[model samples]
Target: MNKLIDGFLRFKKNVFPQKRALFRDLAGAQSPTALFITCADSRVVPDLITQSQPGDLFICRTVGNQIPPHGSAPEGGVASSIEYAVHALGVQHVIVCGHSDCGAMNAVLHPERLKDLPSTNAWLKNAAAARSVVLENYVGLVDDVLLHLLAEENIVAQIENLKTHPAVAARLARGELQLHGWFYHIHSGDITTYDAQAGRFAPLDHGSATATPPRRIYHFSAGDAA
Candidate 1:
């Protein structure tokens, strides 16, 4: 922990002074541009990868970058954060980022390894659909390739789960929100974004927007109210 403390001291003495005005403006309130949801892996630093300032991105991290579908657990941390970011904070973008060589993904691929981690295994059920997609569809692939496919599919799964949130669904209906799925290569420091048109993850281009396909809006029919 000394390293963290020393880093904080350096920030306070040097970086803090440099960005004093920015912090001052953000002291009373914050208006971040996006809601970044990613794996809780140390290597996937959201701000560092995005090069965003303190008040730029509101982040939520979870193992495997999983997002439980809405109503599965309404009071859950991820659900609450999504609601606050969209309804309260008015963030326009919600990103689900997964990384290469993710330990959580590896665990998903090998469930036997998680027998001691009951809670973790339970939580990873959120990615079960992704696991099924990868295993059933991508046959004959090597272990490493399968792991990578699981990570990518998990990101896509989480994005679909994000839409189930009431806040996200409502905003999406109005064409006000955009969803993005990202894969970050830990070793190479490369990022690829899901391209709806291409139906694949493509290299991220600076100054360009990479968004998920249009979401299906839920219509509440009057007859169903009976």
Candidate 2:
């Protein structure tokens, strides 16, 4: 508590003042270009990872970067946030990012270890598909390697889930928005983007890549609607 308080005090005394003009400009209005969704883990800082400043990215953080499919359950915060980002803010891109060593993925990978976290256990039910993908595809890998693979697979899974939202689907259909799946390697400072054509996540800088354009994800588009 004291450490958090000290951090806040330091922000107030040093950081906030230095960025006051930027904050003041952002105070009136914001027109962020992307809706970045990721885990609620302390180590994953969306802005820091993207090198973005305030007003550049609208963000939503969940336990496992899970976005429930549309119409599957009662409308929730994640749904509302996605709707607002697309329809209201007119964000061009929606990025679902997952990272290595994610506790949520760990819970799914080892449900037996989550005996005490009932709420978390319930929340992670959304990631069942992701768990199955990892188990079915990469059965033998364990520890960091297993977790890393699961993290990448989870991002791809969530991107599919994001398409289930009505507004997102409609926008995508009309070529008004784009969706992206990214896996961030926390330990190596590496980032991988899902290649729809190759059906895999490849290093962002992989030259001579045959991956589909980042704009044409899952047959969705970002141009004027028909």
Candidate 3:
């Protein structure tokens, strides 16, 4: 905790003064560009990765980055945030990012581990589609590779769930929003975005945009990826 306190002090004394004007402007309100949703992994810092300022992105972090499909839960906290970001903040984009070796994905692949974590077990059912998708398509795969694919697929599944929200559906219908699926490779510090046309997670490039409400689901095999 001392480290965090010291960092705050440094920010107040040095960094705060440097960006005082920007802070003053943001004091009353904030208009972020994107709604970035990712796992609650301490290592994945959205600001650090995207080089964003304080008001650049509105972030939502969940255990598995799970987003329950609309109507599955009534006015859930996650859905409330999605509504706020879309209706109130008018964010242009929503990115569902999942990382390598995700604990939630691990539990999904290994159900026995969840015997003691009943609440988590139920919560992860929101992402149950991911496990099924992998099982149906990627036969004979197991261990780390299977888990890796599960993480990637979970991001895709959650993004689909995100679209089910009334706010997101309305905005998408009006062409006012874009949704993204991202896989962040923790060990390598690399980000691969799902390309709806290509139907695979490839290195994200500034030249291209993530598919908006993809008609087809993106899938990958261990050998098929370059």
Candidate 4:
């Protein structure tokens, strides 16, 4: 952990001093504008990717970026965070981001490989609909292409799952909130966002705003939702 301590030391001596005023203002209260839900992958740094500063985004990181459906359990960590970010923090936007070369997605695509990882396998059940979408429809494709498709589909799946939450649903119905699906191409640092009108994920070009539909309505079979 020397590397982390050294990084913190550098931040304390250099970065924190420069942003002292910003931190002071944030010390009292925070009014973040967005709730960023992403994978617990070290490579996908949300703040760095969005160029957001402290107090700008409320973040929730989960394995595979999976969000359990509302009421699936009485109490859940992800659910609580989602409720607070939407109902309490009043975040206007909710972004579910997935990335290429995701280990969690890999395990979702191949449950056989997760036999030894019972907890991980159980956690990824939230991503089952995405896996079903790819396996049932994108038959015959394999390797990187299949992996890429699954990642995108997983983002879409999770966004749908987001709608089931009461806080998110209420805001959406009143036109007070927006949901976005993002795919981060790690190697190129290129980001693609879901475009409801075009029915595909297109490059999230700089200086452009893409507001995803509350639900893009992917055709996941009934069994998949289980």
For lDDT, the strongest prediction is 1
lDDT of 4 by residue, 69-120 (tens): 9998532999999999999999999999999999999998888999999988
Candidate 4 regions with alpha-carbon error over 4 angstroms: 206-211, 214-226
- Candidate 2 or 4, higher TM-score? 4
Pairs in steric clash, model 1: none
Q: Looking at model 4, which ten-residue stretch has the lowest summed lDDT?
A: 208-217
Please, what is the whole-model Cα lDDT of each candidate in the order they appear? 0.91, 0.83, 0.87, 0.90
Candidate 3 TM-score over all chains jointly: 0.91
Q: Put the candidates in lDDT order, highest first.
A: 1, 4, 3, 2
Q: Which 10-residue span in candidate 1 carries the lowest summed lDDT?
A: 207-216
lDDT per residue as tens, model 1, 1-226: 9999999999999999999999999999999999999999999999999999999999999999999998884329999899999999999899899999999999999999999999999999998999999999999999999999999989988888988899998998877788988999999999999875676888888644556544656667999889
In model 2, what are the clashing residue pairs, if there are any? 175-221, 175-222, 175-223
Candidate order, TM-score descending: 1, 4, 3, 2
The ten-residue window of minimal lDDT in model 3 covers 211-220
TM-score preference between candidates 1 and 4, better one: 1
* Candidate 3: tens digits of C-alpha lDDT, residues 5-113: 9999999999999999999999999999999998898988899988999999999988899998888853387888899999999999999999998998999998899
Off by over 4 Å in 1: 206-209, 213-226
Q: What are the clashing pairs of model 3?
A: none
